[model samples]
Target: MDPRADSPDDAGTLPHVLVLGGGFGGLWATRALAAAPVRITLVDRTNHHLFQPLLYQVATAGLSAPDVAAPLRHILRKQANATVRLDEVRAIDPHARRVALAQGQLHYDYLVVATGSTHAYFGHDEWAGFAPGLKTLDDALAIRTRVLSAFEAAEREDDPLQRAAWLNFVVIGGGPTGVELAGTLAEIARHTLPREFRRAEVRDARIHLVEAGPRVLAAMPEDLSEKTRQQLQRLGVQVHTGDAVTAIDAEGITLAGRRLASRTVLWAAGVAASPLGSQLGAPTDRAGRVLVAPDLSLPGHPEVLVIGDLASVTQDGKPVPGVAPAAKQMGAHAAAVIRDRLRGVAGEPFRYRDYGNLATIGRMAAVVHFGRLKLSGLLAWWFWLVAHLFFLIGFRNRIIVLTNWAWSYWTYQRHARIIVGRPPPDE
Candidate 1:
């Protein structure tokens, strides 16, 4: 099929599909439907598709912002059926099959709500000031600056207590992102930054990984979580489990009624669905995710579908896990549904295939489980690296990430460590 053949159907006779958000789900939906005979309009507040899994790398100064994001227009300009719109979707009128955007309204024969999610600080939103979460490129860069500046401050401070506080780094949550950040930061403090700082013992810097749950990577298998916890502990990260953070401030965090002094705190705890889900009046669960049917469609509104992190679909009577592969599968399923509907053919319901779960603890330690198959240590780490490299958006990104990883592995150093943006101007 000619990829550009579907562009000239401006007469509005063909089906018009509107996809909201340019993240993994929306981008995958557009790609899957590229060859279909439909007019596709992709709208997003930002003009880029972000690789969220690698966002921690940016926060740890291992990768640059542009290395993990691709311009939306540049990504879809070659597809005849696809048109990228830089607009924030304010609301969705499912009854009328219309989307309200900042500039104008768009009518769709089929609507795909792929709006992603944002970090949630539970009821204590004020804690965001002291503990920032990693979600956007700006967030990563800000974290990178704060992390690097702490070492700088420690090097210059004359008081031993003040220097110690500056050297202490605390990370909340034991998810994949938190584990990666804590491990990478611990490596930097113990190995990389010690050579760069004088008068201060960077190697003595304290890195803490706190989890409210009993173990890290709670979603993974028990053995994997235990292995990850052990690996992190070996890397000089103080792992605290079964403790909830009560408060956070510039000085440090309060856990189990005990106060820890630290200058840098990273939040990787919880997340809520995109506001777009609420705007649609769709039934949402506790996390604000739209509760979709087995086929990932809105009930009483078959033409409208919700997918990715913004949606909650069930398999085996349990909610599907929110991950990149799940989002991709949902996007592809939505596209298949649209194709079948257009061709007047009945299709099967969406079924998700378990592709196993993988998480890397540090440079040489990782874990992977697929069905009854399990792997760990160097083998799992190699698999993790290969899986991520293959899933990255473009060849350029893959090459850049591979080269950076190679360089870091060889020298134990990170290159994208430059601090941008001026410090806050005197309050």
Candidate 2:
């Protein structure tokens, strides 16, 4: 029996909706439920919802963390029905409709698991210490420190080999993050950092983007992928595809049996779903993503819904890409379903709509593929900028981001490259 069914008169009592993880999905779910006859409790380890698409800009010193993120409370301050809890989820009990947190537990009539994903070092967990992935603010800051500090260390080094090792930067992935990082580094080399160094020649900096796939942006169309590869190469990024990194260490990386010495390596290769998906009592894919139904609910537990990177959704025989737009749509669909059911109406099936695929190479260069439509070069770059600016939360953030982009465009210099905070002792 449905929990709400036991108390029919309690329909207006405001059903409790528990949303886990304040990422794109959970944030959207909480926002969508704010207007409904529901009390929402959003839980996350942090107080802010990060805009992950522009995270590369943060890592590369193009933008600061706040410019791409907003506090959760500030975002939902006006929503009286919604509240946020800065607590980490430890476990989920589907049968009892309870989620175990670090401090206590939360019970709900409707539970949404949008805990998102984390980087997968494959089987080599030790590699993470050397090659950090860009997921959170700390990771970006750490990368910035490593990149900037490398130049500093090289300037003082007397040995040529040691200086070259410090100047060598490797990005282990050819996806959007890797491509963006590599392209930005090229821009820094070609335009920005010449004056930063007095002794070390900045031109010796080598940026290599390594990928196991045959081309960059493999998820996109082949033509677009080729275009991106060309753009990356044109920007002086060494695009290496069809070769896998066999080993990674603080000293360097070994790819396709070839050893390359480097001190800075960024990982953008793989991602796995959060561990909360295992508590759903449902089947999961290889990446530990819960295999959710069309409605994004566990097989026998309709009250329990999963979205974002945690839910493995297949549509039209193709798995839905784990992107922000898809997560937002899933969150909205789940919200609409709950709202309709609360009114004693049947809920419709959830359908995912593919907006398009876009990846930027550098200034005035990007590739976009939407169905049969294909665009690249300056026009696509403009579209990418507009889309990212429009989607960024908060008017202040949008304005700040637009101003930063305009400044970077005319000057070809990234402003937020200063490394702050203490990194790990090894870094």
State which candidate has the highest lDDT: 2
lDDT of 2 at 397: 100
Give lDDT tens digits, candidate 2, residues 237-322: 89999999999988999999989999989999999999888889999999999998778888899888899999998988999999
lDDT by candidate, in order shown: 0.87, 0.88
Residue-wise C-alpha lDDT for candidate 1, range 167-236, written one tens digit per residue: 8999999998899999999999987888887699999999999999999999888988998988998999
Candidate 1 steric clashes: 0
How does model 1 score by TM-score?
Answer: 0.95
Quote the positional error of residue 338 for candidate 2 in Å.
1.3
| Count of steric clashes across candidates, in order | 0, 0
Output the worst ten-in-a-row residue range by lDDT, candidate 2. 2-11
TM-score for all predictions?
A: 0.95, 0.95
